[model samples]
Target chain A: MKNIIIASTSTIHGGEYLEYLLPELSKHFKNCKTILFIPYARPSGITHEEYTAKASLAFAKINIAVKGIHEFENATSAIENAEGIFTGGGSTFVLVNELYRNNIMTVLSQTIKKGTPYLGTSAGSVICGLSMQNTNDMPIVYPPSFQTTGVIPFNINAHYLDPDTQSKHMGETRETRIKEFHAYNTIPVLGLREGSWLDVKGSKILLKGNLSARLFRQNQVAEEIESETDVSYIK
Target chain B: MKNIIIASTSTIHGGEYLEYLLPELSKHFKNCKTILFIPYARPSGITHEEYTAKASLAFAKINIAVKGIHEFENATSAIENAEGIFTGGGSTFVLVNELYRNNIMTVLSQTIKKGTPYLGTSAGSVICGLSMQNTNDMPIVYPPSFQTTGVIPFNINAHYLDPDTQSKHMGETRETRIKEFHAYNTIPVLGLREGSWLDVKGSKILLKGNLSARLFRQNQVAEEIESETDVSYIK
Candidate 1:
C-alpha cells in the first residue's frame, strides 16, 4: 500500500521551517527510521548541503534521520533503499530538471508507488501530479519535459492564493492561471492553499487541513472542495 | 534605430484596456496608419479575433487601425511589412510558442530593429528581453525554447509586485523568484512594476512612468532605478 502526504507548503507564514506540519509529519513517517531527502529545488539558490541540513533539522525533531540523495554514489540506489522519501519545496523547474538530469524520476516514482512512505511539500507536491504546468514558480530553468509522476490523476497548484479584491495589480490571479492551463490541457488541477494537503493512503486520497481547495475541471466552473473530502474522484 | 515602448502592463487596475498608455502610443504610432497586432497571448484564453477586436478598440482612439497577425497569409511577411507592431498581454508561453511556430520571431526582431515602431505590453514586453525565464505566468504551454528577442540587453519581470508586509502567504516573493533566475542566468533583470515602462529609441533605453523599477544583476544586490533614468547602461 502507498502512503503519501502532499502539502501545499512546508511552512506557514510566521512559522519556522516545517514547524506547522511537524506533528502530522511525525505520524506520517513514524515507522521510518531514516528518510532520503531531495533538495534540488534550491529555493533562493541555496546549495544542496544547506537545504539538506535544514531538512535534517526538521526530521530530527520527529526522531527520523534525513540524508540528502546527493550524498549517495547512485541516486537510484539511494532511493531504492530509503525507508521513506521527503522532497521539499522550491523552484519546480530546478527540481524537475535535476530529476531528469539524474535519470532518477522513474525510479523515485516507482519507489514511492511500491509502498515507500513519501512526503512532498510545494514543488514536491506538484511533481506528484500529471505535470508541473500548474506551478506558480518562475521558469528559472527549462526542464526537459513538464511531465511528472502522475501518482495522482490531476495536477497540483501549490500555495494557491485567492484574488485580492482590494489590490490594484494587473497580474493574472491564481484562478485565471489555472483556467488558462485548462484551456491547453484536460488535466484537472487542485488549488491547494498554504497549510492544506492531501493525505493519500493506498487508493484513498483525502483532503487534509482547515481550508477548502479550489478544484478546476476543463470547461467547468471552479468549485471549492471541503476539507476531509475524498479527492480521488476529481478526475 | 529602434522606436519601442515596452510597458509593464496594457492596463492598470480599474482602468480600461491600454488606457494608461494611449497618449504615449499615439505618438509612438503617429506615422503609421495601421499596426500589426499579435494576439497569440490571448489573455483570459480569448480568441485571436476577440483579442484583436479589443486592441482595435484601443488603437482606434489614436486614429490607428489594428489587424491581428493571424489574419495574414504569411506571419513573417505580415511582421516584416508592418508599419508598427504591438503584442498584447497574456500568457508568455502561448505567445512565444506561437512566435516560434509561425517562424516570425527573428523577422519581428529584425523589423523592430530596422526602426519600425513597436509597442509591447506585459508578455509582449518581456519578449523584448533575453528570455522569458522571469515571467510570473503559469507554464500552461511549453515553448520550444526559453529564449526571446534580446532586443534589450536584460530580462524584464513584467507587472512586478512588491512583497506585501501584511500578507500571510508563504509563497516566494517577486524578489526571491528573480534572485533564483540570476542563480542560473547571468542576464540582468528589471522588475517593472505596473504602470511603468521603458522607452527605447535608437541606443538609449529610458525608464518611463512615475515609479522606480527594481534591477537585479547577477551576484549584485538589487537596486531601484528611478523613472526617466536611462537603463541602457545596465548590461
Candidate 2:
C-alpha cells in the first residue's frame, strides 16, 4: 500500500507557508514522530540549511521532527529509514537533477511503495508522476534525465492557472501548454490548481481540495474533476 | 556580419501573426527573394504544410516567398543554402529536438554566421541565445541537449510577462523563474516583451520597438533597457 499527498502548492494566497494544509497534513502524516525532508528543489535558490529550517518550523506545528536528506551521509538509506518523506517545492529541474545525482530515485519509490507516508508540493508533486514533461517550472538547469519516482501513474502540472479573460499577455495559457505537451506525449496530465491536492491511499487517488482539477488526456476534451472524486483512472 | 531580428513574439495582442514586425522584417530581408521557414516549433501541433501556409500568407505582404525546411531532402543543406531564414514560434523543446534530430544545429549556426539574413520569433529567438534555459515554453519533448546556437551572448525569455499585482495566483513569476535560472547558470537573460525585438547587425545588438526590455544578470539587480538603446555591451 502507498500513502501520499501531492499538493499543488506549499502555500495559498495570503497564507503562511504550508499553513493552509497543516490540518490535512497532520492527519496524513499521523503516527509519525519525524519526517525526512528533501530540500533539493531550493525555491528562489535558498541554501539547503535555510530551506530545511522553514520545513522544520512548518512540521513543528504538527509536533513532528524534520530532517533534510543532505544532513545524512547516505540519502538512499535515509529514504529507506524515513518514517515519512516530504519533498518541498522550488525548481523541478533542480529537484529531479539532485534525485538522479544522489541515485536515490529508486530507493525513494521503494520507500513510498512500502507504505511510508509521503507528501509533495509544487516541484515535489511533479516528481511523483511518470515524467517531468508536464512541469511548468523553468528549465533553470538541465537534469541528467526527466525521469521521476513514478509513484503516480500520470504527470502533474502544479500551480496550474486558468486563462485570464482580460489579460493582454501573448504567452500561451496553461491549457495551451498542456495541449502542446499532449502533442508529443500520451500520458495524462492533471492541472492541479493552488490549494488543491491528491490524496493517495493504497491504489486509489482522490482529489482533495475545494476547487476542481483540470484533467487533460490525449485526443479528448479536457474535463474538470470535481473535488473529492477518484482520479486514479487517469492512468 | 550577422543579420538577425530576434522578436519577442510573432503576433501581438490584437494583430495577425507577424503583422507587427512586417516593416522591420521587410527591410532586414530586403533583396532576399525567398526565405527558409523552419516550422519545427509547430505551434498548437499545426502541420508543416499548414504552418508554412500561414507563414507564406504573412510573408506575401512583404513580397517574400516562404518555404518550410521539411520540403528539403536534407535539412542541414537547406539551412546552409537559404537566402533568408525564419524560425517561427511554438514549443522551444520541440524545435530544439527537431533541430538536433535533423542534425542541423551546427549548420544552422554556421549558416547564420555566414550572413544569411535571419529572423526568429519566440522559440526561434530562444535558440539564437546561449541556451534554451530561458525559454518560457513548456517542455513537451526532451531534446538531445539544452545547448543551442550561441549566436547571441545571452539567453532569451520570450513573451516575458510582468507580475500582476492584483492576481491571486501563487505560481512563480517570470522574474522569479529567471532568477532561479541564474542560480545554476551565470548566463545573462533578456526578458523581451511582446512587440519588442532585437536588431542584431554585425557586432551591434540594439533593442527595437517602443517597449523597454528587461535585462537580468547573475548576482545583480535586473535592469530595464530602453528601446532604441545600443545594448551590444551586454555581452
What does the lDDT read for residue B142 in candidate 2? 87
Model 1 / residue B144 / CA error / Å: 0.5
Candidate 2 deviant stretches above 4 angstroms: none
Which residues of candidate 1, in runs, are more than 4 Å off? Answer: none
* Model 1, C-alpha of B21: deviation from truth (Å): 0.9
In Å, residue A55's CA in model 2 sits off its true spot by: 0.5
DockQ for all models: 0.89, 0.87
- Label model 2 with its docking quality class: high
CA lDDT, every model vs. true structure: 0.94, 0.93
Accuracy of chain B in candidate 2 (TM-score):
0.99
**What are the clashing pairs of model 1?**
none
